[model samples]
Target: MFQHSRLTEFLLGLFAATSILAPSAAHALGGDGDKVVARVVTFGGACEKCDLSGRRMSGAQILGANFSGAALVGSDMRSVRVLGANFSGADLSRADLTDSEMIGSNFSNANLSNARLRGVQARGVAFSSAIMVKADLRDTEAQGANFSRADLSSAQFNDTSLQGAVLSRVDGRGASFRDAALQGANLSSGRFDRAIFVDASMDGAVLNGGQFDGADFRDASLHRAALFGADLSGARNLDQDQINHACSDASTRLPKGLVPRTCRGVTPHWSPKAPPAPPAPPAPPRP
Candidate 1:
């Protein structure tokens, strides 16, 4: 699901559109010149289809750099490290990447609309089919990230952890995910219209066929969550004893007072919630 390989040894042959290398005027930064010639450089060469639009490269390191199909509009890259960088099909619109480390970075089909990625570490990042509309990713850790079919409309992810993340078929309309952890996340067929899972944990999350129109699961936990054929029409602070404590079936589709859990494949009652409070540290370097 993460393509863009031109026989990657720093993407061999580098596919044309070169001639934007104008570094020396005491190592210039703006005007897209410097091409990261080591004021803080760690880039080991190869920049396929590079333009590096509006480059500044704050705190540049560029670990294992390749930058496949690069443009990087409005680039600043605050606190950049870019660990295992590939940036597949990169554009990075309005990029800042605040407090970036970007572990195992690929960013498959990367666009990163309105990118900031606050407190970014991005552990095991792939971001398959990534666009990341309105990306901020506040307090990001991105544990076990994949983000399959990603669009992430109005993305914020306040206090994000994303543990064991896959996020299959993600669209995430009006996404917020406040106090997010997403324990054992898979989030199959996700759309999440008007999404805002306040105090979120999503324990043992799977969320099969998720769509949750007007979603706002206040004080959200969802212990041992599954929600087979999940729809949750007009979901807002979901009640009915939190869908009878989790693991739904009978083709789960609730909204008005709820009552549909008769598929009895039960065995998911651990109720463990108190672990998501460690992500608010790394946003201090952009001076």
Candidate 2:
């Protein structure tokens, strides 16, 4: 009878110890730095306008967290998973988001100026009307993401894949897009003055009614792209054949030696098409 009582007491002590250590272990995941750890990252707590500046948030899971109007300047968010998190109107200037997964994340009207989004996989993310001036999006895959009306002046998009992205009416003055793929993207009515498109592929993209004054398209491919009513006056590095292959309208202003009749005869369509066959395999080499 005495032994049974002792065993019960020991079990009670062990339970008490485990309960005491569990909360500490959970809290340790949020970092014990100088920044306030009012909320844990794993469980996710509401901290709107939270001062998360200079915090080390690498590989942290902050799903559905409300960080609207939060100050996240210079934060290291590399490889972090922030699925469905709300960052509307948040200040993320100079933040490093390399390889981060922000699927379906909301960055609407947020200030992401000078942020580094290299290698980020942000499929279906919404960045509508966000301020992303001078941001670097090198090698980022943000397919079907929305950036409509966003201010992307002086941004760099080297080797980025923005297939089917919504970039309608975006202000992209002086932006550089080296070898970037924007297939089937919506670029309607946007301002792209002085933008560089070196070796970029924008096949089947809709650029209707956009302002492309002085934009450079050196070695860029626009096969089957719809430029209906787009203003390409004074656009550099473009040839007659490149404008002929694309669909434009009477309102589309072309460079010198390239007539508007090439694109003005037909309506613009935004769909991929197979290349022409090689003359029936050259008649089977004449047998």
Candidate 3:
């Protein structure tokens, strides 16, 4: 009941906190130091030298706040409101931000390696070049967010919603997204080596020039998805009962229960491939 009660308090307390801080919070927007820095000290937490590592901050309104160069590694900021907050260069490794709201938050160059951001709402947030290796982002709502060139290796995001998000050139080795929704998302040239996408949706998603070596795609949906050029060496879990052969081809690694065929080769990241050859003639009566 402690976790449930904490979640309830998170909603109520954060709502009240935002109501109280909404007017004054606007003054600290866009690189204002003094106005946003006071709250870090007012809470009287263990932020000595700006180190909130492993602390628990479940319910809080931190709009337009600047946490540049701060260290919040392993902290718990679940269900909090963090709109327009700046977290540049912050160490958010292993932090828990579940069910939190982070509209227009900036996490440029932040170190969020192994962080837990499950079930969170993160609209218009920027994680450009951020390090999120092995993070857990299951069931999260991250529409219109930008994760360009981010390192998302070994991340887990099952059933997550990432509509219209940009993950261009991301390093997503060993990432898992079973049953996740990625409609209209652009993941072009991203390195998804050994990734898993069981029963996931990829409608209108661009997976051009990406790697899928040893990847798993059991029962996944790729309706109208673009796979211009990508590698599919040693892929698993692809069956004809799950996906049709007409869905994705040679450049794509087919899962189990399917046969290997000549697919379009579009190498991702490292080098581009040449165009396909002309059609070949059929054999004459098997002579």
* Cα-based TM-score, every candidate: 0.34, 0.77, 0.69
Deviation in angstroms for 168 in model 2? 0.9
| Sliding window of 10 residues with minimal summed lDDT for model 1 | 10-19
Give the Å error, residue 146, model 1: 13
Top candidate when judged by TM-score against the true structure: 2
Q: Tens digit of lDDT per residue, candidate 2, span 60-137?
A: 666566678888898877778777677999999999888888876789999999999999987778899999999998
Best by lDDT: 2
Q: Which lDDT tens digits does candidate 1 get at residues 68-129?
A: 77887877778787776688888988899898787776888889888888998887688888
lDDT of 2: 0.75
Candidate 3 residue-wise lDDT, 1-287, digit = tens: 12333333443454345335544464655333322432342111111125657555665556555566678888768777676667877899989888888776788788889898998877667888999999898898877678899998999878988777888899988999888887767788998888998887776677777777777877776655666565654557655543342235556655444543333443222111221221222222221
Better of 1 and 2 by TM-score: 2
